[model samples]
Target: MSATPPPTSSPELKRVVTGALVGTALEWYDFFIYGTAAALVFNRLFFTDSDPAAGTIAAFATFGVGFVVRPFGGVLFGHLGDKIGRRSTLIITTLIMGVSTGLIGLLPTHPAIGVWAPILLTLLRVCQGLGAGAEFGGAATLLAEHAPPGRRGYYASFAQTGVQIGLVLGTSAFLLVQLLPEEDFLAWGWRLPFLVSFALIGVALYVRLRVAESPVFREMERTREIVRLPIKDALARHPRNFLVGVGAHINDTAIVYTLSTFSVAYATAELGMSNHGALFGVILFALTVIVLQPVYGNLSDRVGRRPLNLFSVVFVALFVYPYFLMVDTGVPWLVWLAMMIMGAFGFAPQVAVQPVFYAELFGARVRYTGFAASRELGAALAGFSPLIGAALAARLDGAPWLVAAFLIGTAVISFVAFYASRETKDIDIADIADIDIAGIDPVRKPVAEE
Candidate 1:
């Protein structure tokens, strides 16, 4: 919002990137651990029912509960992030997420406390949701604002890289604990993963606290350009970008969960795959995503975000049927290959350009609120995907075609979104608020006196 923007230097970029990436990885570790637990252990451990099928559904319901409140969390924290500073807002969100996850470790189960166990479990999950709702939006905004324009996609993509790393760390934690005796695992091993959130909180706080606030937000503040209500403006002024942001998230959210969370369960329960084997596929998928995110991001920087966005969804759409078909084979190598392919072609490019794409979609004044609230609302909508996949499989006698069709539907939504959006790789992120949605009218003057 300042009349003149500040220059970004190479040194500052590295520091911001590290802080944002590391903090995001740690915070999302808390979130991913809960998802892995809901898939693997919570069904049996927390619920009162002995029916494995019912319990699994109940466990997944709790997982869905966390997503239910994410939009609220995004709006709340996004407002703070837009109103206050990105650095301080992110610190608070980190604390909220880490502390809630750690407490989940200490909660008693159904045998110990009956119905209270699940009720309390869902409560803690909501807290995690609130914290996570805006974590990536804030991190990406910070990194994007600090990055040089030509390489904005490359720099901001590290936040997504952190996301893959979190998934790996979370799955690795479960994989290690799975080696324990079954009795010990059900009794205590499951809690170990959640407990790690405590230590992660300390490390995350150190890094997040050191990170500087976004220069764009700081400039807005210095120029007295901060809006009284960011979320409202985001919706009222940039409705097209907001809707596109929501749709842009549908495919990745649904497909990633279908691949990572639901597939893990479906493989073990239906395909007769071992727990360890199915989880290994997840690790492979995450590693592939971790490697490809930056590659796609750097490529987006060169070729522009639109091309990658469009190509990524179409390729992923064509692969959905094969992804399920390969997983149904019951061969370890086949399953691993299947998951990796989904990660590379299905999930990577969309996520790679995602952060900077959202950053470019809205002006500085509403960036955090718009980017976070819109994306998380989409996530909340697709958050039930694993539950949907499981329910569909159960009804159709384990047939996966319905689920495949379901996934293709989400991909179509995201493809329309990507196609509808204008190119933003060349836009001035700091000055977008000055132009109206049609890009021809003056929305506001950058300087206060004007």
Candidate 2:
């Protein structure tokens, strides 16, 4: 019942992939700097209550706020992505993210604004969550649809690569500002990273404005196959994929925040490590992930996505305890090594293969809604990971066993999800009938089309 996509030329595919990469990289850079600020600056600047531990948890709670509202963003933007087109939806998302980030750089702190400070920060974070909700999903979908059937994994991985680049840029911006005196860093330098978004917004706009629409979506439009309520249709028609995508996302979402945001706060608070050192570990970890994304992605293209997904969760489950042990050693080199090892095998492979894997779970009609909502829901559920890590560590008097156990539990969830889901690397994404969704009904069409 699906229309065939127009044949995509190689040059167009490359152009789209490049745009997705540059645009996502810039957007995610905004997301990551906020994480860094939560770890280092927000607690002191915005949530200036007593109790250092409580303040840290409060800061991370605001960080989690961005994740909690993501499903709403998913629904709103996913509708636009499925209804209008992927290209325009991505451009809107980038605009939302970039503008919100730039505003954060100019916000007044608690000392100047009192209670209004945290309130405004929370409000701005909601804006970020909304924009971010669909950024990755739309980028991945666009890349997957443009990609040749055999190379979807390899190409879609670029979306994730852009995310790592953003992490590098976000962390690197903080690192540069760290060269300032501590007083200067706390006063004005912290704002510099967020302010860079002003510049990045332009670059993102330039790239995204040039990207082509998904050919699969074009075919859907040409044949009037657009869905009216895509989220409802996705849930009713492809419940299994909806659930699999949700469960499959928990491990990476929780672990990445735990490793990047929580671990930074943990090291500075408990291990007596300098903020510079802990942030350096994240940079190293991100660099490792950036390097291995394409390697794992290309491998998934050859061997299939399931194996890498399974291996990643299992490795992460087993490695969490050892990971904590290495970090607790308080040795800078060992900490960097711990981050890299986990980032390499534990996080990168699954994440690299994830976009294409999720992309193939539904037909193009529901792909944006299903992927963004399900994945972001998992993220919402785990969004409090850094807060949880802080609370658990405080409860245990700085011991990390409880947090380790929590991560292992998340890993188990994803392992079961990967086991239940079918391999999708070889599937034709445009063929609604051939996708691996359960109880997929092909005759259902949108009540209205754009």
How many residue pairs collide in each prediction? Answer: 0, 0
1-450: candidate 1 lDDT, tens digit per residue:
646568666677777888888899988888988888888899888875758877777888888888889989989999999999888999999999999999999999999999999999999999999999999999999988888868889989999999889899989999999999999999999999899999999999888776777788778888898889999899987888899999999999998778778898899988999989998999999999898888889998889998998888898879988988898898999999999988898889899999998888888888899999999999999998888888888888877889999998998999999998888776667767633456543234345534
Native-vs-model 2 lDDT?
A: 0.90
Instruction: Write model 2 residue lDDT over 320-405, tens digit each, in one string.
Output: 99999999999999999999999999999999999998888777888999889999998899889999989899889988899999
TM-score, model 2 to reference = 0.96
> Measured by TM-score, how close is model 1 to the native structure?
0.97
lDDT of 2 at 28: 93
| lDDT against true structure, model 1 | 0.87
In candidate 1, stretches whose alpha carbon ends up further than 4 angstroms from where it belongs are 434-450
